[model samples]
Target: METTDFSQPIRQSAKGIIVIFAFNLVTFVKKFFVLFIAFGVSILRSKSIGNVTPTMMVLAVIGVLLIILIIAILKYLNFKFYLSKDDFHLATGIINKDNTIIPKSKIQNVYIKQNFLQQIINVVSVKIETAGDKKSEIEISALDKPTALLLKKKLFRKASSVSEELEQSESIEEPEVFFKVTPKRLLLEGLSQNHFKSFLLIFTFGFGLYSEFKDFLQELELEKHVEGLVELDEATILNLIITNVIILIGVVLISFLFSVVKTFIINFNLEVVEHQKTIEINKGLFNKVSLSLTPSRIQNLVITTNRVKQYFGLHTIAVKQAMVNVKQQKNFNIVALEKEQLDYLVNKLLSNYNDEQGDVAKPRPYFMRISALEMFLFGVVINGLSLAIFGIEMLWINAVFMPLAALYVYFAYKKAYYRISEDFVTIGSGVIDTTTNILEIHKIQSVKLKQTIFQRPRAIASLVISTASKSVTIPYISKSEAISIYNLLLYKVESQDRDWM
Candidate 1:
């Protein structure tokens, strides 16, 4: 009997047709959404159009969908993939067939995910990412859970001799899970989140949605009823305060609910598992996500916390990997972890994990000056808006908010510091939610120096240091100090023989 060879070409699941069809259909609609809306409005306004009734419009949409489905079928039929000992191969495209060959040594990560649609369809997606060319990432959109797992394991293992590989099938060891999020900790993390940011996000989104329905609400006379409830024109100072307090309370409640629900859906059952040479993250509720990462691939370990989170013994950790697509993917976060758990993970990932600090250096007072001016401008805009919209009765808001905002700026300035140690440089910023980013000197890829006209006169500059994963900026530092640090970082990078990846 002959052993089955993976080098032979294989097709993805037939249900890939459905996934491709759905993807293409959504893309098509999004591409022409505004045009379609405009056309529909014109059709409705015109009384002379004979063949453009609502039923006809629906049929037209159906015809477009059918055409998209045909294209998806052709694309799915043309797709083929295979694995060789040294490389992986993919053949795709309908009208123009593309053959892509990727080296096995260059494979960075493999992610398995199931979105809402895929969950309903009972299929999963496998994403194979390389260190370069994010556009070339390979995705198998529709595979059964078992097949996807088998494929992932096969792709992730080290190469072996033909006979040895054949005999050693199912050779991978089980991963040890070192960290998991508990329900109680998750709740505490949600409660300690920056709800002001959530409130702002909700306000921005709601304002945009309200703009779309502004005229409709006016037509229904709902705006007048709301105005009557508030009595903006004739209300006394006490009444005004009561209305504002009620509105503020309502917004606070909504923001709190949004943050808690969002946290649960995103981080439910989050766990970190370890293998011999890699780490795996499994998380998400409605949309399940599994990520595999190598220690050498990680570039940044960022930890964030506020006073409330500190009291709850919680921190949010974000892992930044080399060559990962930030725009296409969400940040890899391990939420609601303790200090000890974080230290273990950091030491495991980063070999030179030193928590010692030499000297905490601050940017010159010019940074404070800039921040104050910016805050002043913000105050002007906010107070101006309040005065214009709500009359002089709202002028007291600045007396209440400005002092608190100024104190926040002062705290942020006090928090901003950079400490360079033997092998790492720590950058700290933020007041309400303090975020610390640790960067290794050996991994520094490039260093940039910049100076504005105002900064140059004062011998001040901004130092921008970039690693394989991300960049960090140290602004409003002395020009000579920035240059000295820049030179030191470059020298360390050159002296080290370590691979940044």
Candidate 2:
């Protein structure tokens, strides 16, 4: 594989760091304000709010200003960046210069962002990401857009070649026009689906109303100072309930509308293109993110089915890759599809492969029953503690909740289980909201077996399989079974001579 050095351009751009200093100045000012607020609040709560001494106030102000100025001066004096043959380097700081090197082979993606100001100035911001950190590998604030893109492409090519060697397989196929969520489907999904944002909005509105009513009641001191501000008659009670119900309905409707608008904007012009060796996803009206990933990078696949969707026999599949930086990785890389479409896509990603036998390991039925017992005990302890904290006012609630809690715990534990197959590992869990994760053998990085005191008596244990970026744990298994899986994984890693990452 061939690589290009980006050292000269990065170094040249780093000199005379006026802009860098200015950015740091703004950051320092923000931090200073935060500190000021915290200090002022602390002092005000303990003593007279308006009795702050002039000396103290002047000293605080001077301290904030000095800190900001010192940071700005350092930034102006010490910022620098350069490119190495296989990596890029950045050095900054006046007193103790910090050096960072990002290997080209680890580069996952590169991005260019330009706001209205950048468009006018003919300069762009460049962000390079690698599988090293959740933050950007390097951020170049101002650069000629064409030159930046050229450099990004050159690095991407080098990274892709190295990744190909690692996979040791021919390039994966990319479809010309892959499946996409259209405007109509997006709208339908939003209205029919129970999205996180929708529930959050509903919760917010309800909580706000409750808080305001509670505050107003406290201020009125109704029981202590009963006044006829608003007559508490039958008409008043009826009106209050009706108004609250109307508000709740409105909240639901508004939540649905917000979801629809968000879905429409995000999936607008959504497209996924597959190349011979990689897949590229492009979409979004604002703050767009373009992600490219090879099939071999995928660590696990999750298929989720909600109650309503389950009734319709529909499921949404999310493809998870082992990118070290979760934030820098792609969203919607896990596309929603019908069952057949989902199966087809999974097959394509997996491709034709030899079915190497997986090490045998199975949790016995008794282990699952024990898991249920543990869950029930946990619920009892938690509710018991809550009752002690809240007193008799909550005693009645706990009495009614006892059985329900036990049942829930029992179901939760009963649902938790795992199975190792010839080429993959499957874990199923959840009581009210069940989910099964399917992970390929090659995707696993490490396997751990653990035994608790109670589990030791029963010869039961737990297994945690770690991927490049995520971990899935099986709560209850036999100790012997856990050992078998761990040993197999150790053997595979050593034989391959490649880090799980």
Candidate 3:
């Protein structure tokens, strides 16, 4: 193990001052946007009233920049981090000092990222995330690439060594490169993205732009002229339809282009490598990101594909990690894989990958019965409400949906299934877009079985399997079956010596 001198505090790269200043400025603006706007307006008013000259305004800007620079310098001076054999320690803050010590075992992920600025400076930001924290426990804004890589390797080594000691075993298997996203595959993935989502995004952006334009026109007292130029009432019905068609085509094109560009940028040169104990992912274009995670840390795995992607024989895999009360979103998802590759990756990455070979268990016949009854009741209530609010005519209109509701219920009941194996449990559900959630049995935090008053009469129960991050439920199963699965999961949780992150 590489030993570092702990007597001296390890400071960030000199480029960190610039990064800190920018970060502080962004924080200041975000926290007090109204204040910033008010300040700007006041300055403009003063200048217009001849109370402040252009030179004075320039001086004010320079003064603010100087103050920010001094604050950044102070922060840089105060901020320091050093790694001990067992723990990583950080000391930060200028006025309110904070000293944090995080044990090696608690560290769930270590990420190195570089934004455009940091990339230009040849420095990367390091984020050390703990198991339960929403944000990184420690963040080094700027570190040389080599230093960051060394620190990451050291921390991971310390963590792995401790685990090996506890288990009294070590695996010397060579790391394998599982998958890499080529430019063509990336383009396919981008094209396969949900068009509805892209359309909505484009619609929102267009609406916002239109609103801003309207506001600008109103400010300039040219609203009437703008309205005259695009008179809606003067257009014929045919002209209106043609115009709308053209607009819709334009919007869809823009949305598609934006989605393709964004996806390409985000997933550029994506690569996935797997070691005996961990999986590492590297990707991104403008802002490069590298992440490492152990299989034990994964709460569940979701493999998703739409009709188009299915036709293309591609799937996107996402792993959910144990995040207790973490509000921040993590971008650890991977995209564009063939079924064979997906199976290979799963087999190599998950300890319980063979669980899929086990017999799949579908919900009992009572599930369909209960679903039908529920749908009928729901329809009755909806029709009743419609009748009360808008008379018999509305009730008749809603009555048309009663059969559709029943069909939906039947499909849902048919799709719901759960399977358990020695080491993992898989829950499969969804109607239009199917989803299968695979979770390691040892990682299950809790298993809940509940029977409603209506369900109890039929001896049917709902089972909820929960992890640190999310819960998966299998509804309308036989009460006895639910109990058996729950007990088995509990046993796995108790008996397994495996660490869940």
Candidate 4:
């Protein structure tokens, strides 16, 4: 294909107009929900009170719909995207146009999504992301599946010959399946999820709903009935307690069901397929998302397991790549499975992965003393303030909590450790919830050694290793140890020939 022909601008699929319109409508409603609701109520009241006719309300609705449709059409007409040899270019806008040129080398990942509507129409939405961009640089709302796949392949490989090779390989060989989620394992993972967090979310949601209901009742001048319940006799208080218990049970059941359904939908039929140089993930129910990950671009690997998951011998692995913005980092989850399966997948995906638990170096012994002292000081300050304001009656509560706080800090200090290998560095932290972060030594972008005034006397410092996506800090290590690790990492990064991104 000639460069000029391939670089020519092309519009999105025709159905994209509808998709864009729906997306814009939803966005507008979300941003101005309160204004929209108030305006709608005013219009409805006008009609009800004979200030406005039904015909007028109908006309207003039609006008708003027509405006939204026109905006969507204009957006569709303005959007154009194409690929050059070195850069992917996108031009879009209604009034003030935006031209974005993303270098092919900087492209981190390409995501393809198909919602229920897109599935019915046989089209997909493609998102092109780069390292520094918080949002996808280029988003084709709707494109024919074949065209989208071709564009994706060409953009990633940056060569027409590679596309041809991929096509030929697909015809000749099947991709190796690395791991897949079984229904039983999926159920176990869902059941073992953090129920306390789910309960908190449910509680917050219930409170918000109650607040909205109270406002609605007040709007209708019916809040007096609710306030009357506050003047409670013994029978009324007993009845209230029973009623609250029943309501709480219902809420908990609903929240649990929601959590299960959400987990199932998100991880439904999750599969990992390994190609020659990359891995492909396909999953989800209503909105199916497919992502391609290159091993060379991975920054760190985090394997996490809570107490409940540990009990079931399950672990969740999160793969962090070269993301410029922390908020935009999409930690690709390959699978949540048993330790054996997790180790197998990790070894396969990362050739340098070590299954052996190597000897880890702990912080200095004084680290625990420092941690306990800090916790004790904090507890004393908090207890002193409470005593001055609330009264000495609450002294017993502080007496119970201070020791617990100190114990937690002691455990946290004990859990913190670092292990450095010839090729990789592993840092483990956290108390009740443990997380281990592993990063290839050569991929480190920078290193820093820090010391505070208190630590200066002890000759202890903190070492921070920064990669493209995130940083890992080992605190309260000996200054000499921190300097040695820093120099070693810098030397490794400088000596490597591989690209960090």
Best by TM-score: 1
Better of 2 and 3 by lDDT: 3
Give the per-residue lDDT of model 2 (tens digit) for 332-392: 4443456676666666666642234334334566665765567668767766876787765
Cα lDDT of all candidates, in order? 0.82, 0.64, 0.79, 0.79
Give the TM-score comparing model 1 with the true structure, all chains together. Answer: 0.86
Candidate 2 CA-lDDT value: 0.64
Q: Residue 450 CA error for candidate 2 (Å)? A: 1.5
Candidate 1 local lDDT, 196-273, one digit each (tens)? 899998778867887899899677767656666776555555665897798778778889888988999999899999
Local lDDT at 458 for model 3? 81
lDDT tens readout by residue for model 3, 239-300: 66997899999999888888889888888888998766678888889989988867767788
After superposition, candidate 4 runs with Cα above 4 Å error? 1-8, 46-54, 159-171, 203-258, 324-331, 357-359, 369-407
Query: Model 4, 480: alpha-carbon shift in Å?
Result: 1.3
288 Cα displacement, candidate 2 (Å): 1.6
User: CA shift at 230, candidate 3, in angstroms?
Assistant: 18
Give candidate 3's total backbone clashes.
0
Candidate 4, 26-132: lDDT as tens digits: 89779889986886797677654355666776787788888999999999999999888788889999999999888887788888888887887778999888777
- What's the lDDT for candidate 4? 0.79
